[model samples]
Structure formats: C-alpha cells, structure tokens
Target chain A: MNEIPQIELTGITRVYGKGEIAVRALDGIDLTVAAGEFIAIMGPSGSGKSTAMNVIGCLDSPTSGHYRFNGVEVGRLSQDQRALLRRHYLGFVFQGYNLLPRASALHNVELPLIYKGLGRAERHNAAHEALRKVGLDNRAHHDPSELSGGQQQRVAIARALVGSPQVMLADEPTGNLDTKRSIEIMEVLQDLNRSDGLTIVMVTHEEDMAEYAQRRIWMVDGRIERDERTRKAA
Target chain B: MLWETFRLAIQAIFRNAMRSFLTVLGIVIGVAAVISMVTVGQGSTQQVTADVEKLGTNVVMVLPGQDTMQGGPGGTADPMFTLRINDAVEDQIASVALSAPISQSRARVIFGNENRRTDIVGTDNRYFEAARWDLNRGRFFELSELQSGKAVCVIGETVRESLFGFADPVGETVRIKTLSCEVVGLLKSKGASTFGSDQDDFVILPIKTFHRRIAGNTDVSTLFVSVRDGASIERTMEEITALMRDLRRIGRGEEDDFEVVDMEQFATMLSGITDILTGLLSAVAAVSLLVGGIGIMNIMLVSVTERTREIGIRLAIGAQARQVLLQFLVEAIVLSLIGGLIGIALGLALAVLGANWLSIPFTPDPGIIMLAFGFSALVGVVFGFFPARRAARLDPIEALRHE
Candidate 1:
C-alpha cells in the first residue's frame, strides 16, 4: 500500500542538560516508517534507543527536531496535545510489564479505554477481546501479582491493544522474561502483525529478540550504525 | 470520568485500610473535641438562660451590697445599709409593677417525725408574681392573717415531700425552731436550676409573722421589684438607683450603697461567658485540625512517593496529569470525609453522655456539624494539593525507571 508514512523524524537532536555538561542522546537522526512495518532498534547502554522510543511515543519531546505523525507536525504540539496523540494513536508496553499490581487483568486492560472515554460495557468487551488476542482471556480476573511474568506481559499487551492504537511502542517487552516466555511473547506480537497488519516499533538489546522484526536498526553512540531488512513478510 | 476516578481512589484507599485510618485519626479527635465541647457548652448556656428566665426578666433584685454575685455584703454590715420592708412599700415609682421584701435564713423545720434543714423566706404574695412562682395547691396567706402577724407559712414542694411525704401539708402545723407555723400552701415543683440546686426547697412565711415570731426583728435583706412589661429595664434600674440614693440621702457623686441587679443582664452576661468559653475551646480544637491536615499532607507525600511506579504506568498508558491529580485528591478527600463522619458520631455520643452527667439539656447543633464536614473536606483539598501536584508533574520516563 502506497500511503503517507505513519512516522517521520528529520534532523532529530535530543540533548540532555546544557552548556559544558551537555549530552546529546539523539544526534541528527532522520527516519521514516510505513503504516504496517514492524521495526526493531537494538543498542547497548547509553546508545539512545530508549530515548528514540520515548520521542516516538510522544512521552518526551526532542530538543531540536521535526516529528510528523500521520502527516501532522507533532513536534510543535503542546504537552496535552501530545498526550492526546499518545492516548489515541500510540500504545506502550514497558519491559517491567507495568500492569497495575492491585488491578485485575481485565481492569488493567481497561485502563487505556478509560482514557479513551469508552463506556463501561464497551470497554469491558474491548478489553476481553484484547486479552483473547494475547491468549490470556482466562486470566482476566486475576491480579498482576497472581499472574506469571509471561501472563503479566500479555496483560500489558492487552491493555495496549484495547485502545486499538495506530502504532505499538514496546520498550523491551520481554526483557524481564525467561527465554521461553520471551519466545512466547514474540510469537504473540508476530501473529498480531501478520494477521492484523499492525504497525510496531520495538527496542531490544537481545539479537534473537530483534530477529523477530521484519526490519532492524542498530544504534551506537547516538547514531544509527546499521539498517537492514532481514526478511520479507510471511 | 469523575465516578471512575472516585472508584479508583476508594479502591486504593481500601488497599491499605489500616494506614488510611491511622492517617485520619488526628482529624477524628479534633472534630470530636470541637463538636462535643460546643454542644455541651450550648446546653449549659441554654440551661442558664432557662433558669434566669424562670426568675422573670422583668424582675430586678435590690441587694444590700455591691458584687453580690460573689456572696453577701461587700461593704460594712451597718444596720442603716440594710433593706427594710418599708422600702418595698413605696408605690411612687412609675415603672414598678410589683415589689416584695424578702429576708431568708436557713432553718430546720419539723413536721411529725420528719425534720430537714431548708431555707426560710419571708415575703408576701407579691413575691410569687415578681419571682414567677406558682402554688401547686392550697391558698396563700390572707391579708388579715398577714396583718395580724399570724404564724402561718407556705411550704415548698421539697419541704412538703420531706416533711409530709404523700400526705397534704396544708392545714398541718410545721415547727420552725420553737414556733409552730401553719402550712397554708404548697409551691409547685420547679425541678433543678442551672446550678443544679433545687428551686422547690424553700419555705415561705409572711414577713410580719417572720419578724415577730422567727426573726425577732424587722430587717429585709433583699427586695424583689418587677417592672411594668412596657418599661425599659435599664430605665427602671436607673430610677430604682436614684430612689434608693434619695431614700438613703446619699450625695450625687457617691456610689449607691445598694446594688440593683437586672436578672436579664445577668443572664446575658452568663451566656456571653459561655459563648467565649465555647469559642476558646473550639479554637484549641481547630489547632488539632490543622495538625490533622499536616498529618494528611505528610501521608499523601509518602503515598505519592510509594506509588511513583504506578503513576508512571498510568502516565505511560496516556492518563492526563489532571486525571492523576484528581485521583490522589479524591483519595485524600474520601479519607478525611470518613474521619469526619466518625468524629461526628463520636462527638454526638460524647455530647449526650456529658449532658446526662452534667444534668444539662443535650442540644446537637446541625449547623456546626455541617461546618465540620465542610471544613474537613476543605482540609482535604488544601492539604491534598501539593502531593497530588507532585504526582501529576512526574516525568513518566524518569518515573518508570524508579524502583
């Protein structure tokens, strides 16, 4: 499909602190992603992969950049406007599987829908569907503490997908899981991408985990050192 | 949205029920103290007002000295300074409705085998009208009996109860000292006064009979003067003062030897004093409320810190800063409101118990309860703000990295 890119970043430069003590997290980066591509960013510590994800998720603004989302200039938007963008178009799954510890799996999934202002019954159904997609519908009533690490990450993914965002930004979604649980999570993400054609941008240092993505970008010292398409879609 | 936020807040508060309760304990004690103190204070003030009303606001007592509230005569015990029955005989004053001379002495009365020490008052029937006392049964002393200085008396309900029990005391003769006095009437029951003294515990005798038989002299220690309903009490008091000064032949600049005490003014002063006491105590209790607010602030700060990761999760999931603020603010308010409700219940219970113990009426002021509730909610808002703001302003990236 020939459509406007889902994300575009031009001359993105993110600098922390100021003057003599300045540190640039992302130095003059330019990139674009189509509507249905799955991309992975791999880097070591201080390589700025997380910072790039933050910028893409609209959780943090870049120091100097032009960021466009679905052809709209996002860099000039206010903080609240960015939040609304995140609420409507971006879903985040952190490495810690940040489901509310006290909330049931169903309620945790319902969190994004609550911000989306969905009605109770409608949110409930959507959350159940999302949980079913992640193959954790049976664990909906269980709290995060009662669930396994894989189960908790699935719940977090269900929460992200409940809003049906335009893009999912998962920062090391399987970082805390064992290799077996990590492969299981990768399979879920791969199945969603294959069947639903969902756009995704994931960050991971594990090479095998990054191999699940259709395209891979390796970063070093705030610059992209390698970019390659490993394989075609299934 | 608001309902959902409240639900979330309630859930979070219930998650740590013990901590929430302990955090609100200060508010509970402060509110309870303020409510009970004000309630008990109001009850006593009302009792005092009722007691003074029974004395008849239109009535003014002319005592033979100054500062009689402390006790008897403040100056010299000169015979010339004492009130006489003749002083009450003057009907020349325009504001005077009724005037009766009263002289009282504590004496033991005996009827059959029963004998109890009680106050013996010497006054005519006009004292009943001036002092608002009504007879429960039998007749007052007739004019002929009063003129002849007959040894007749009217017994109070307490005296009748003590001396005659269930039998009628009228037509019976009660011995006071060596004098046998006929009981002509019985005063009605007035229950307990504001000071917890029995009002129906004195015996009344005709002043002439009292002077000739029991007192053995003509001396009236106090005078009860009732002013006309339409007359100003202050003006009447001034007139009485001038009359007494003229009667005593006092110089213009000299203070009158006698004090004219307005029953209404005394009642007002008593109530004023109680009001100040209630306010002072409530202010002290309010200090505790401030301390309670500080307690809430401290706890909320800790909660915010403890929930940093949770807040990060919420923000990452696209929760607005305002939404997070509202959640924490609602949690604090719910905690405070719970404390307020419990405090109200505890305070009312204490007020009821205090009233029963002190023998005063129990009066629950609804306005004060509403004020307490509103104040607690206000405390929640004021104290909950900073911590809530701190939570809202947190950077999601940094917060997520927090342990």
Candidate 2:
C-alpha cells in the first residue's frame, strides 16, 4: 500500500482485575492497517477479538504497549482526548444493534453530532444525508422498535458514518442476523469500503463473512494466532 | 443536551405508560395531602384569630380569677376580686385613654307582656365606646345616672328584638330583676365573635345600678382600660399592676390580683396553639413528601435495573454518561413538578371550600404554594440522584453482558 497505516497497534496487552484473579484479554498484539484497509478478525469463543477491537477503537485502554490511530498515539491520550479522538476519527458499530430504542432513526444517527456540539440544523441535515446514503432515508423518522433487525443495523451504520470518521470499527455486525440478511449487510459494508475508500476493522467468526475483507486476523486464547492478507486488488 | 435528555425522559415515561403512572402516584398523593392540609389549617387559624381581634381592642374581661372565664364570670363560685381602687386609670394614668367597669348578672327582661332571659352588663358612659357599642336610638343614659345609681339601661339588638319587636324600645320602661328601668338607648348590631359568643345579646346599665340593684355590690367585678395610641401594652399592664397592689394595701411580696389583656396579648396566647398546629401540620405534610421521595427512589432504581441493556446500547453508540444521568433525573423531576402543580390547585380549592363552610373570606398566601413546589422539586433532585448516578456509572461491557 502506498499510504501510511491509518491504525497501528504495536505490542499491545490488556488484562482484567489483579494478581490471582487477573485474566489476560489481549496479549502482545502487533498489527497495522494502511489507509482504506478493511480487516476482519475471527476466533473461537474464548478468544479476545472483541477486547482487541475495543482497544483499537479507543473504547478501552491497553494495559501495556501503545496504540496509534491516524498517527496519534492513543495510549497517551487523556480520557477527554480519547473521547475527542473517537468523535473526530473513529466510528463504532457493536453487535447488539445499539440504536437508542426511543429515539428516531435520525436522532439516533445524530447522537455523535450532539457530542460534537454541532448546531441543530447542521446535525439534522448531516444525519439525513448519512441515512440517505444507507438507502433508509424514508425510515429516518421511525424509532428502532418500528424497524426490522436488518434495517436497525443499517440505521446503526448510518449513525457510525454520520460523523465522517477516518475509520469504522464494527464488532460482529451480522452476529444477530440470519445467513441471508448477513450477506446483505456484508454487501453494504463492502460497497461503502470500496466506493468511499473508508477503512474498516470488523470482528466476526463466520468464514463467509470474513471473505468480504481483504485481510483476516485469527486469535486464540487472547493472542494473535495468525495474520494473513488474501485478496489484494490487482 | 439537557433538552435532549428531557425529551427522552418524557419518552421513557411513556414507554411503559402504566408503570410510570403507578410510580409517580405516591408523589402525587403525598403532594396533594401536604398542600391541602397546611392550606386549610392555616386558613382556619387565620380566620379564628381575625374574628377574635374583631371583638374589641378595648375589652379585657377579668372573671374574678387567674384563668380566663368563658362568656363572663356570672356569679361563679370563684372568689370575687372586684375593682377596689380608682381604677379609671386611663384619665388618671398617662398610658390609659379611658377605663370602665362591668358586672354581669343573668336576669329576665320584662317588656309589656313579653319576657326574655338575658345578661345585664352594668358599667359607665365610657363602656359604650370601649366595647364598640354604637347607639341605634336616642342616646346613652346621662352620666348622672351612673353616679346616682338611677334605673336606666341600654338594650342590645337581641333584647330589643325579643321584648319589643318593631317598637322603639328607647324611652320605654323594662323590668329587670323585678326592678323597673327606663331604656334610654339601643345598640347597633355587631356580628357573632370568634368565641361564638352572641355579641348582640343582653343589656347595659349604669354601674351604680348594677351594684345596688342587680348585683347588689359596690365593688366592680371587671375593669377594662383603653390605652391611647394602642402601643406599649406591657407598660400599661405594669402600671395597672403597681396601681392595684398599692390601692389594695397588699404587702411588697403579695401578688397583684388583676389581669390587663389586649389584642396583642390575646394574639400571643392564641398563637401558641396555632403555631403548634401549623408546625405539626407542616411536619406531617413534609413526611408525606419524604415518603413520596422514597417512592421515587424505589421506582427509579427499578428503572435503572430494567434499562441496563438500553444503557449499554447508548454507551456503545456515542452517548455519554451525563446524557444517561440527565435523562433519568429529568424524569423524576418532571414527575414531581407535575404532582406539585396539581397539589397547588387542590390546596387552593380546599382552602376556599373550607373558608366558605366557615363563612369567612379565604385568602391563600402565595408564599406557601411557592415553598411547597420548591420543596417537591428539591425532593426530586435529592431522591433521584443515586439512581441517575448509578445509571451513569454503569460499565458498558458489564451492562451489555447482563441477561
């Protein structure tokens, strides 16, 4: 890749609790993603792929070692700075379809804009633009309860993209969906990644879903077992 | 952001609808109870006090004892301690404007053929003005009748109505205690007083006649002294005590056997009971509010527990901890505010209704409503705090992991 890495994790480690009760979640992880790279992580149940993703997304801190997002060292950032980083650079999608159930799809998507302290009209216009890009503009006024599982996920994606972040971190995006719906979501994510050249790092276990990404990383017992790049563009 | 939280809070209450209504029901009832009880109690006490003051600023009926007598001490078993000195201290003492003596005795009044049992009040010319008695007929009896013990009297509206009906009772003769007396004057009607005593009852006569003919005594049973400018009641009382002690020839250590009372003194005595009632009612009302606060806390804790998953979802989707806290806190405050508003209306209504029942004008102090609403909102903040903080402090990972 000609561009410098957008996200880099070097010798990162995360452990929970202390001493006898302590459990390691991510052990000595070394990874790098160039600009516009799409990477997927896959593992068994005991693996800490989700923990690793949280660290990369700046949602959690690494116990040891450093994480750099867009060339800024995330490990050294303050809590407010981390929040600022999340606002300015990183977008997140969790497996639970984390749309606020009481909020309209437009409001849910506009949440990050609220944190950014954007004006009402600007945020509304931006949220509608993002929802339109997801092909669910008509459903923007509907609450999450009114939408199906797949459509809710689409609204979530719109929320993630609303702030126009440098990278999108999704943890098991299709984990709650059926096989047919899973492929449809994967197709949407793939189109966004290719068309906008948006860098995305996703965690999943389904082999077919992993095939949509250009690179894959496998984890075993909180450690990276393998890293492979399989589908480089010609 | 606060506005956003407010909107979501309203939405959250609507989510379960029934649960939210049930949760805030305690607060509503408690607020209404406090507002109504205090308002009505305050109104009644105020009405009673005003009525008492309206009786007369000049009248202080000493019923031959230390403890005050109901109505008048009409030949009661208590030892007589009547006026023994030149007790007309107002013209004598600088503090006093005027002084008068009254002795009450019950007797049947006979006018023509009709007869009615009534009280005979024996006093001087000053008694008419001091007791707020206005002449409705010719005039009060001449001052010579007071000194000569003449059989002259002034009748009240009730006595006039019962004995003479529409006839001019003035310039007519009536038999009291088997002694014939000329009615030289009639009194204008004053309404029933706070003690529920009939102010328009009985007859007034010269003190000399009351002593020699009706009551058969030269001593006065009660002395009422009106002060000029209506200030320094204590000074006037002190001088009266000193005057009584000196005139009675009692030793230095002996206590004076008289009481001088005014509106302020009466107000002081009555304020004790009213204050106690006011405090107790307010405390009971406050307890109800406290119970309401506890109810809010209980419901909010449950809400926090119920919305754990939802909280996790929001946290993952870029919602900050403050947003979560503000939402729940706003929900509680809104509930309380609505309850407070309803309570203010109910309280005012109860006060007016109570006033109407008692036949008194109702005036609600706006201060009470402000204080009540302020207290409720404060309760919401204090009680809703822990739950809101708990929601804010929740770990996203752990919350999402909950079943």
Candidate 3:
C-alpha cells in the first residue's frame, strides 16, 4: 500500500451567488500536497488565490469537488466535523495578524489550545513554548496593539503553532510588514520548515516571499496556471 | 468549556464598562419596579388582614339585608324586606359565645357649649363581649337600665373628649337631639377601624332607649356574633344561616334576604384583590424587562459587529460556532443576573420606604424575589438567542475581511 498524501483536491469548483450574477471563485482545480512539504500559492488580484486558500483551509466549501485530508473525505464532513479537523490538523495565520486587540500576547497564543480543551497550565506552557520559537516570549503579557507589527505577527504565528497542527496555512503572513520585518517572519518560517519538519502552505504575490517555499503553484482566473518544484527540501 | 466561555464573556463585558452599564440599566429599572411593586402590594394585603383580624377574630356579622351596602355598623333597612333576626336568634346558635343585636342612628350630642354629630349605636350588655370593646372608666348599663329603656349612654373616647374635654363625663348628662341622656360610662379607645372610620367615635346606648326615643321603631339592623374559641366557624355560620332562614319563614330554595359576613372571608377577599393587583403591576413592570432584554440584544449585536475581526481570529483558531454562540449567550445572562441582584436590593429598599409611607407592614416575600430574578434570567435567554445565533453564523472569511 502507498502512503496517502496530506491533502488532495480533485475537480474542486467554488461558485459564489446565483443566476446571471454567479462568479466562479475556484474553477475545476486539482492539486495534491505531500507531508512535510512547504508550498506557496502566488497570483495577482482577482486570480482566486485567496479564495483557493480559504477553500483549502476548510473555511469555505467547494461547490463541486472531492476534498480529501489525510485519506479522509473532508468535503463530505459537517461544519462541526471540519472544525474538529481544523482543531487537530490545521493552523491558520492571516495578513492582518488577527490577534484579539484586548488580549495579551500569551492569551492570543493560548486560543487554539483553549479550544483543544487543554488545561490552563498546559495551554500556558505550550503557548509559551510557541512564543519562544517566534522569539516573542518576553512580550507575552503585552496586548497585540501594544506590540509592533512584526511582534504582533509573531504572536499570531505562535498561536498557529501552539496546537502542534499538521499543517500551517499563512495567508500573506508578512503582507503588512516592511522589508526588515518581512525577512524576520520569513526566517522564522524557514527555521520551522527546516528544523521541525512542519508542513506549510503560504499564499503571497511577492516573488521574494514565494522563493522561501520549496514548491510554487501559480493561480490565474480561478485555475492553476503553473505548478513547479523550485527547490529541494532542507 | 462553559466555564471558559463564561470567563471570556465576563472579560468582554468588562472591556467596555460604560457600554455594559448602559446596556444593563433597563434591566435594573425593570427588576426593581417589579420587586418593589410586588413587595409593597404584599405588605398592603397583610395590613388589611391584620386590621380585619383586629376587628375581632372569628366574628360573623348577620346583616338585615343582603350584601347591598358596605360598612361595618351601617346598613339600610328595607320596608318590604322583612328578615330581622331578633335577640332570640342569638340564643339559638350553640357556637355563639356572645351575640348582640345593634341598631344605629345619627345624633347631635350637646353638653355645655361643646357639641358634635356622631353615630349612636344601640345594643345590649353583650356588645362589650361580641365587639371586643373595653371600659376605661364608669360602669356598663345595668339590667334595670336596659329593661326600663332609660336614657343612659356610654361615650367613646372621641365623644367623651368632644362633649367633656379632659373633665370626667361619667356622671354628666348630654342632650341627644331632643332627649337628654346621662353619661353612665366611658369606652376605651380602639383607634381607627380598617375602613378608616374611627372606632372610638361612636356612642353606645341601651337598644330599648334607642328604639323608643330616637328611632320610634323596634328594629335591629346588624347582629354582631362572636363564635366560641376552637369552634368550626363554617358550621356555626351554617347553623346561624339556617336559624335565620327559619325565623324569617324563607323556603329552602329561596335566597335569604340577610347575609352573614365573616371577617375571615372579608380578609381573604381583600387579599385576593391585592394579589391580582400585585401580579398586574409586576407584569407591567416586566414589560420594562423585555425592553431591557432588547437593549442587551441590541448591544450584543453591536458588539458582535464591532468585533468581527476578533470573531474571525477565534474561528480560525478552531473555535466551534457553538462555542462562539455560547460565549455571547453567557454574556447576556451575566448582565441580567447582575442587574437582578442590584434590582432586588433597590426594590427591597423601596419596599421598606413604601411600607412606612403607606402605613402597611413591611413584608418581604421571598417567592416574588425568586420569581423576579428567574424572569430576568429568562429575559436574557429569550432575548439573547438571536444576537448569539447571528454571531455564530458569521463566515470567518468575510469576518476576517470585515475591517
């Protein structure tokens, strides 16, 4: 028996609205990703790159497709089942570094573990370890707004990593950062990919950000325009 | 999981303190109004019962006519209706410890320069026993005075004060309209009756004297009957009704022209009316609770909208939609519970003050307190559902892009 891929999408289509106003956000897309692979999705605006990321994240469902995650049919799962899958298997990081404004860095990072039903002490320790990985452990008690842009994004990354998810999905993780902070975020991703054997899926339009990934998939007009292995895994 | 949700909800509420307080204000007023109104009403009912009980327990009044008029000692006599339970009917009921047939008429009493118009009650020596009247000075009318129909009277506290000032009026004579009656006794003060009439205002005289000189007729309108202790009042009242019907020659099926008014029945009737009034008032006040709940819902909706991005972050971090819903719902409940607590305290304070002002007993009803609190919580659940569902149903993708 052959080992199953981490994620497989066959003939996935996602349509928005209805009638004449209908828009095909993801049109008949097929893709497969192996375990421990670091991939980047790159596209221009209105090319369905973000929509594809949402579909792959299980935050949006495909209109017609087979979505399998680790040998299980995810497309057939209920909303709560998808949530449970996300709880144990996936981590998400957004361009906005979407940490709760009123919550401290530690609390923001503890969110995923809290949903995992981990005890308070266990959640705190795991969140602290993740923050240490992102080099934001010292700023754990500060509110997200009180931290700089780079530090806030680091807290979000810590939140994603705290639950030890099988895959980390980052939607333009450094989109709001300057060159200096973008490099800092890219280095952290590079370190995780190299040292932890963590699977990672990132979406970005920047060529420099895409270069950090070992593989690149380019989307155009709701379909994959190009797929290539750009570099060998570290 | 619920505990964490509750903690998060509380934290979120405290994040915007001013907004939270304003949101709960309506609930506070509503709960306070319901609690205070119910409390004061219960107090009034208790007051009415106590006042009636003070009139003399286990006392039944047999009036000459049906319940056509309202007053303790005054009832109109009809010329055509001829059911009068005479003094002989008093002796027929075995449960009767004391009974007195009373007849009343208005009279202007004058002694020296002081004069006042007052109610003149005519009854036998049993009036003191049945009506629970006490004497402070002088003697009650002797058997000779009652039989001879002599012009002798016992003045109540108010009557004695009006006609004789602080001076003793036991040996003096006071003119009653046309007849001059000797003041043979002074009755003790019983203060005011429940109906606001001064119990110490009426003057008492021998029944025969009142009939021969003042009324010019031998008729009694009310028979005050006090039952013996430990006797069944219902059975006694039934016995009295049967005897009265037989004496009046009324058939078994015919409605007796006279009605027996029991003090217990009167108390129950008065309290029933109070309970209805309290319920109505509390219900009206509960309308404000609805408004308060709506306020909570409105604010919760606004909060969910305002925190769309936060919600998106929570969703992406693997929070179930139901968890989000539970969080907001618990927030609403916490707000109402706090409001209920404060309202209970405020209501109790208001009730105490109202009791003093209204001259009723301060009776705190635990049942009403619990009811008000439980109703407030229900308001939370009922009004909290829509907003929470809206929050839970938000798409994480759209919420992430809300800003």
**Winner by DockQ:** 1
lDDT, candidate 3, equals 0.86
- The most accurate candidate by TM-score is 1
Model 2, chain B only, scores a TM-score of 0.72
lDDT over C-alpha atoms for residue B79 of model 1: 39
Which lDDT value does model 1 have at A166? 85
Query: lDDT tens string, model 1, A1-234?
Result: 767899999999899999999999999878899888899999998999999999999999989989999988898777678778889998888899977887899999999888888889999999999999999999999999999999999998888888889899999999999999999999888887778888999999998888889999898888888889866432
- What does candidate 2's lDDT look like per residue over B1-403, in tens digits? 6776677777777887788777666666666676666666666566567655554654444434463354355634334555445464554578777777777889999988999999888888877776667888878878688779899999889899999989998889999976899999889987555455677888888888888888777767777666666657677777777666665666987654556566656765665676688678778777877988888899989989988977765665556777778877898888677677777777778768866665555777778888888987888898899999999887766776665
Against the unseen true structure, what C-alpha lDDT does each candidate score? 0.88, 0.79, 0.86
Error of 2 at A188 (Å): 2.0
CAPRI verdict on model 2? acceptable
Superior candidate under lDDT, 2 versus 3: 3
Chain B TM (all candidates): 0.87, 0.72, 0.72
Q: Each model's TM-score, in the order given? A: 0.90, 0.78, 0.77
- Lowest lDDT 10-mer window, candidate 1 chain A? A225-234
Per-prediction DockQ: 0.67, 0.29, 0.57
Q: Which candidate, 1 or 2, has the higher lDDT? A: 1
The weakest ten consecutive residues by lDDT in model 3 chain B span B77-86
Model 3 chain A worst lDDT run, 10 consecutive residues: A225-234
Worst 10 residues of 2 chain A by lDDT: A76-85
Error of 3 at B39 (Å): 3.4
